[model samples]
Target: MVIGLWLASLLLALLTLLPLWRFEAWWVRGLDFPRLQLAVLAVVIVVLQLLFTDLTQFNQWSMLLISSGCLLFQLWWILPYTPLFSKEVMATAADSTSPCIAILNSNVLGPNRNAQALIDLVKQHQPDILVTLESNSWWQQQLDQLSDSYPHSVKCPLDNLYGMHVYSRLPLHNASLQFLVEEGVPSIHAEAELTDGSRIAVHFLHPAPPSPSENYSSEERDAELLVVASSVKDVTTPVIVAGDLNDVAWSETTRLFRKISGLLDPRIGRGMFNSFHADYPFMRWPLDHIFHSSHFTLQQLQRLPSIGSDHFPMLVRLCYTGRQQPQDGVDPDQDDKQLAQDKMMAQAVAPDQVHRPETQAVP
Candidate 1:
């Protein structure tokens, strides 16, 4: 029985390191979760190792291997908590009062027919801007009533998963939808003129997830996000980028995106606002996010009610101050972080790249 326990402990320790392999298999991706589970298993292995010290006859070399594996797994488990991986930024003071702009991001399931629930949610919040993803022609028409309330609009209704629509009460100057990653995947880029006369740049995206039917790998998705991050790096205007990133806030890629873009995540010091898998709350991660440049301050962030969609909308209100200045104690060299993001995006957007699909604009 002692031999069996030792072998079992060794197997568990080895299993914890499997996620380190960069593979496209579902089993590999599924292991993205359960880091905590692996941590617990590592602890159990250590306890077993200590208890079995008396059973030296059971292959000393095998026991040494198991102990070393457990130690490595323990180190991997705590890596995320390290400061080098993720940094927290505090909200800064702003001169403008009442500069709040409320934004709602919702993914209306393409096939779901209940549009009234979504309309009701919008009515209840009355946000300054509403961005809907996975919207088709039918979904666009269903939301036509909103045009009267929000005079400015940008709509791209494609059958592809990247279909997107943006409606805003604020004037959207030079607003255009661009496919930064894939041909049909649209991202809205515009200068929003706030009620207080301050201009803010906003970018909205809904990149396709890495999956067999969508794409074989996360290269395209990751690269596209890097492109967006790089574009907003040195802007003088207050900037806000929000969407369903399809990545958790804790992921290494997301952290790199934040550092590269020089954007502030509301989730810092705040809890993870997991927005996906509303049906299975336990399995949810912070997929929907609102990231802002340091020029703005977070006024409010909340999860909206479900409207017959797989994703619950995220509502964030940010107050724009004046442009950040180095003399004012704000770091001027912050834009340097965009270099890595720019390099990644440039490589991903190269003409010969096969991961990104051909983009098609919707009429």
Candidate 2:
């Protein structure tokens, strides 16, 4: 009986550590909100080990290993969500009369039949731009009326989870859909012309999640995001990148992407907008994200209501106020770290030169 109890305690401890070791891997595959669960289990396992000390000789040592592992993983995993370590860039000055642009990003599950709920939500919000992921021909047909309102659009209706569609009320300039990670998995890159003539480059992406059904590892996804970040770094125009990144806000790869891209996340002082797994509130994390260049100020950030999809929509309003003056304090090593990430991105893309797909213009 004592041996069985000891084994059970140890097993629980190991189970808790498993999440810590695989948080990034699980998150990239869209299994969001594992961090909090892992933390809770770790504490419970430690208590169990302490209470059952009489059953095992090395109970304290096992508990220490479990505790240390959980804490270390949490620290490493949570760094991206903490804004103190992230750099903030202000948007370039634009005319005060320009309209505030609002974008709604939604990953409507492909198999979900409730298109009316999503259509109603979009109609209610009246966002300037609406991007939907996992949309098929059926989903596209349901939203046909939207084209009349949007005027400018991009549509890639695929049966795979990669299916993407974008609708813009504003003029879409030089819009092109490219596959950054895998063939046919589209990433929409375009420029939205504001009424005041200021152009903001937008990149919409939905990379494959890391899972047994999908890719076995997250290296491809991480490498793809890093590549996109690198592409945005050199652009002088105002930039905004949004989509289902398949990564949590707290992961190391996400932090590195933000640093390399020189983008700002509105969630800094604000709370995490955990957007995925709407069916299970307790098992949700901020998988979808909105990132903009320093040239813009956040006017509003909100998580829209669920519309029969597994993921909820995110609506963000950004105003193109003139770029503020750079603060005097600059981290000497910051640029170096960014440079390293740039190098990694370059290397990752170099090997796949043959696989690069031709960019298709949005009609």
> Which candidate number has the best TM-score?
2
lDDT of 1 by residue, 95-149 (tens): 5465778899998889878889888888998999999999999999999898999
What's each prediction's TM-score? 0.76, 0.78
- Report clashes for each candidate as comma-separated counts: 3, 10
For candidate 2, the 10 contiguous residues with the lowest summed lDDT are: 351-360
Tell me how far the alpha carbon of residue 295 in candidate 1 is from the true structure, in angstroms, after superposition.
1.0
In candidate 2, residue 302 scores what lDDT? Answer: 86
Model 2, backbone clash pairs (residues 3+ apart or across chains), number: 10
TM-score of candidate 2 relative to the true fold: 0.78
